[model samples]
Target: MRKHKIAVVPGDGVGPEVIAAGLEVLQAVAAADGGFAVESESFDWGSDRYRRLGRMMPEDGVETLRGFDAIYFGAVGDPEIPDHITLWELRLAICQGLDQYANVRPTRLLPGMQGPLRPELGEQIDWVIVRENSEGEYAGVGGRVHAGLPLETGIDVAVFTREGVARICRFACELARSRPRKRLTVVTKSNAQRHGMVFWDAVCREVLADFPDLDVDFKLVDAMAARMVTHPGDIDTVVATNLHADVLSDLASALTGSLGNGATANINPNAGVPSMFEPIHGSAFDITGKGIANPVGAFWTGAMMLEHLGEDAAAERLMKAVERVTENGPRTPDMGGQAGSADVTKAVLAAL
Candidate 1:
């Protein structure tokens, strides 16, 4: 049997709970398929680790993770630790270290699920958000100065380079070309942030030349938000900077149904190293142990991981099973059903 070594990091809060459900579903699918297998090594690396060792992970965490086929990451945040520390030390560290520059998030309304938007706007909210993951606003540049004084100031610099912009735009354009609509909406704030945003627009224009058949347009980030709500059907694939895509994808998730249903892939498109797949939703600390935290995101993320691992048939089967479960009943509280995480997972496994 074809075997894949997976590094599973079930981070803080409901992360472990949801990741457990995802793994169970993955194993079920693999057993049923019988053509391939997965061997996962679980790591206890998160807030509890931070509290005990004064770091989210060991100094050699990234290097150790480099040996895996792919990283199946759950959420990474804790009430006890500051958000910045948790994010930078673990999640960002992995993304940057691995050069997983393309953060792809696909959002669509599942069958029988209702978004906050009008019920009439059925499945038109389908869109793929291609986020420039490595650089941009989350580049970890700048710092604080003159602490705790009247002249105290903090600066978080957004680093954007021509190479970065061109590569991401090319990736987005190629994605758009692959889709049925062949439309790409480039989101930026050129009107306000002249330097970086203008440079971004230029790179997009340059990249669009290579994909002449792609129908492309620009939307200032503010106007793009309204367009997403007012005319989501018009959009098929969207590309944005790191910070903008992060915020917009959350809105896209809520528009589709719930943050619980969102799935993401931090990809190194060149495949030089393993990519990370995860749910876009943050660690819901309030419902950490409640067993109501949604596992659909985790399960969907697993399907994505399967696809990345070249198990397309298994990935499709897994996703179809998830859709079947969502279309039927016994959904988690996030989907307005009374069932808990395990119940929904059971339903998915049965559907599979």
Candidate 2:
């Protein structure tokens, strides 16, 4: 049987709870599939570790992950720690360190789920947001130099490069081509942020030319956000800068159902380095230890990881199981049902 080594990082808050549930469902699917196996090792690197070690993860963390076939990450955040410290030090560090440039988020309204479904739009939402993960607005540029002065200033440069734009455009175009709609929307705030966003627009136009088969269009980020609510069917696949897509995907998720059901894949796309998959919902501290945190996102994320590992059959089985649960099984509080995480897990396992 083929085996895939997975590094499971269940970071902070409700992360551990949902990760546990996801692993159980993953293992169940693996057993039922019968042709493959999943071997996962847990890494406890998060806010608690930071409090003790003065770091979210050890220095050699990314290198350690290199040995694994893929990384299965839970959310990372803490109420005590500054959000920036928690995000940049752990998740972003690993993502940038590993060069996972494409942040793919797939959003689809599950059947029989109550959500912000726009009945007037005349179509159920299905969107894959391809965020330029490694750079662009989130390139980690600029600083706060005058900390204590009257002229105290902080600057965060929304950096963009031809190389970054070209690569992400190509990746998004290819993904759009793979889908049945063959449609893609490139988003940038070029009219307002002239230099960086215009650079983004120009580079994307140049790169998209290579994808002749794809039906592509460009829109300002704000207008795109509006379109998402007013005309969701007009969108199928989207490519945007890190910050833009990060915000948009969350909106996409809420439109479909809940953040608890949103799945994300931080993909390297190259052969050697492993990609990382995680739920889009962060640590969700309020729900920590409550045993009611939703596990659907993590389960969906697990299925994405399986697909990335070339286990398409197993991935399909896992997704169908999740759909079965969503369609006619227990749901957590996030989905307006009385069930706990474990209950949903049980339903998914039974579905498997």
Q: On a 0 to 1 TM-score scale, where does candidate 2 land against the true structure?
A: 0.98
Name the TM-score of candidate 1: 0.99
**Residues 1-352, candidate 2, lDDT per residue (tens digit)?**
9999999999999889989999998888889989889999999899999999999999999999999999999999999999999999999999999999999999888866766755655245888999999887788898998789999999888878788889999999999999999999999998999898889999998988788888889999999999998888899999999999999999988887789999999999899899999998889888889899989999999999999999999899989989999989688888879999989999888888
Q: Over the stretch 1-352, how does candidate 1's per-residue lDDT look in tens digits?
A: 9888899999988999999999999999999999999999999999899999898989998989888899999999988788999999999999998899999999999887999999777478879999999889999999999999999999999999999999999999998998999999999999999999999999889989999999989999999999988888888999999999999999999997789999999999765488999987789999989999999999999999999999999999999999999999788888989999989999999999
Candidate 2 residue spans exceeding 4 A from truth:
120-123
Residue 300 CA displacement from its true place in model 1, Å: 0.7
Q: Per model, how many backbone clashes are there?
A: 0, 0
Residue 319, model 1: Cα distance from true site in angstroms:
0.8
Q: What C-alpha lDDT do the candidate models reach, one value each?
A: 0.92, 0.91
In model 2, the Cα lDDT at residue 182 comes to 99
Please list the residue runs of candidate 1 whose C-alpha ends up more than 4 Å from where it truly belongs after superposition. Answer: none
